[model samples]
Target: MIDTRMIGDVRVTRIHEYSGPTHDPKFLLPDLSQELLESNREWMSPHHWIPLMNKLILTVQLWVVHAGSNIIVVDTGVGNRKPREGMARMHNLNSLVLEWLEAAGAPPDKVTHVALTHLHMDHVGWNTRWLDGRWTPTFPNARYYLPQDDFLFCESGRNKQEGLDVFGASFEDSVMPIVDAGMSVMLKPGMEIGDCLQVEDARGHSPGQVAFRIRSRGEEAIFSGDICHNPIQIVHPEINSGYCIWPDQARKTRMEFLASSADRETLVLPVHFGNPYAGFVRREGAGFRFEPLLW
Candidate 1:
């Protein structure tokens, strides 16, 4: 299923890719306590958490924004036939992302800009596809906007030795092809795209992770990449997903982003979150809470 919302004149749609019980609660969030999980069970159950399986449910999706003449796709989900040797769930397989994209009104050829919040296996997979026996840019007409620090970090081979399959192989297949094709633009902090979207520093989950702020006609929303994998994080802002490379920074960034969203009343659209994937952050007592957007 696809869900869309209009922020003024810009039409933003969430294209579904994969959704299931992805990780153990404690494994995904080391700080999670049984009490905390029970406290939020009323809202998190079924959609965000599976009490029966004791797993945290996550969704891998793409956020396509239609602003004026620009059809910008944010964070492509895992593509077909990628080598995710360590992650069995993400290993070589076929996903109907392209068809989903087409159904959502932003096909590969029609996409004008491809903005990546960060360079991770799941987020960059569809950036390229197997074409004519070689990996090639999926959106031939689009210019990909990649985070500068991540590009440098991945290019340096620093993550090659990391046991987790977040970078090395996927980088070569998904990202490098775009760079080699000269269709990549290194995004910097405060970068603006078409005067509608602004890139802000949202690192910590990955070296150069970012969140895009979409503004139009006094309405606003944020394409928050992985700042909070699950809505539970909004209630417990300090919790970091197991995939987070820099736990401390990740927590700090999440807390700040939640507070800012609550204060600004900005719609928060995270890449992962089950049903009602986007929401508004509400300040609750010492922390914050997620008010899922029904649309």
Candidate 2:
């Protein structure tokens, strides 16, 4: 079943497009020591940790938010066809992203906004689709609110200097098409798309990385982008994915984000958390922990 739950007034549904092992622990987040995994094995096993392969099981999902007649998407998971070199697992492949969206009754055209927390390959893949021998904006009517800094940064082609040009082609295919289609908007921090949704900058993973805080009748949930990819980071906030462009900035942003989420008892909706893609943040000694929302 498609995981759908009401958060105050917004209907937040998880369209789990893909799930499996993507990165080895050492490669996913090098700072995460084996000792840390062993210490937390009692809790993480079977669901999150794969000891044999040492890979953290993660999911690529898109969160669809229904607010005041607006259908907003937070991150479009890996799209169907793209030349995602080096990332063979989900590259040049077929995906059910759109079909699942349709099954949920939220077709691409009905989508009002496609707010990408950042312009990463996986997050922006479905922003466009292969059409007529060329990539084109997938959501014809949705105004995509991408971060200004990120759009410009990626546009500048500086991602090559950052060493993950693996996403270079993705920018050319998924993002640029939206801009050409005149459906892309540069997001500003504190930008409000609706009374229930507001944007906040959470840079580090990407220059323009942003998170959305949705509030309705005082109930709140945060759509935290790649600030922390897996539940393991909730326990060890210092760890950063190897894809992070600014390591120090990424770590700082993560710890602070976790602290606030824990203090506020906010529901955190992340892009790559495994099975239960949405959860709450809780303080666990000096760090924090993810309490998955089974509902």
Candidate 3:
């Protein structure tokens, strides 16, 4: 189920669902080659790998949103019963997130907007659900938002989605319905939905990837999609995940995000990384480190 928290007047929620070995330890390590690690001085640190193997499973967060007039879902996460690639092993379909939303006073039908950080399988799985023998948009009344560049890059057909089918059907089954229904919004940087929300250019992780900046009741928060996978990644922004389409650009984006906002009191909502949703960035050494806020 999803956990809920309120930052001033803005309500932030997250769906704790995923598709993978719940207790796998390998995800904690940077997706780097041994040779690359050996040659790079920056990647060599005690914090390079977490010692508590058992805690690794707690990482990966499926974030949800209840910002302003919209019940915005940042990433849908891996949906139930969908075939996945890599370590994604999800099952037993249930709407724990919807339950949490109801408990938080936001019902499914009341949701006005659904936003995606990227098009990875895990981020878009819950975008649709199996019903009547077909996948359909879960939010019946909401307008689905996706970056145009991200949509084109993933659906371009130039790259092989050999192991990324979990994310494929979302566009065809889930997202297309909204587009066909006229409830889809494609955004560029600086786009404003209302007085309290704005979109910022946060590319690299995915081309044209954008982060949502929310301001309300004198508080500020940025839903940082996959800018940093783990808290450790904050201090090692140079490390790249195997799935990053453009590693060099991803690395640069990570650095810029850290340098621009880590020291300030901005609340950063990263997609993954165990508990403690919001945090401030700190400069530990050559790289920046995440200081998660304790709830």
Q: Whole-model Cα lDDT per candidate?
A: 0.89, 0.84, 0.64
Winner of 1 and 2 under lDDT: 1
- State the lDDT of candidate 2 residue by residue for 87-174, as single tens digits: 7877887877788888876899998898889988888889988889999888887899888888888888788787776356778889
- Which residue pairs in candidate 3 have backbone atoms (N, alpha carbon, C) closer than 3 angstroms, thus clashing? 19-89, 20-89, 262-281
* Cα lDDT tens digits for candidate 1, 1-295: 7888899999999988889998888987878887899888899999999998989998899989998899999999888998788788889869788898999889899999999999988899999999899999999999999999989988877777565446658789999999999999999889997567899999999899999998888888999999999999998888888888888999899988998999999999998898888899998888888898989
Q: After superposition, how far is residue 245 of candidate 2 from its true place, in Å?
A: 1.2
Total clashing pairs in model 2:
0
Model 3 Cα displacement at 167 (Å)?
Answer: 4.2
TM-score of each prediction: 0.96, 0.96, 0.81
lDDT of 2: 0.84
Please give the TM-score that candidate 3 achieves against the real structure. Answer: 0.81
Give the higher-TM-score candidate: 1 or 3.
1
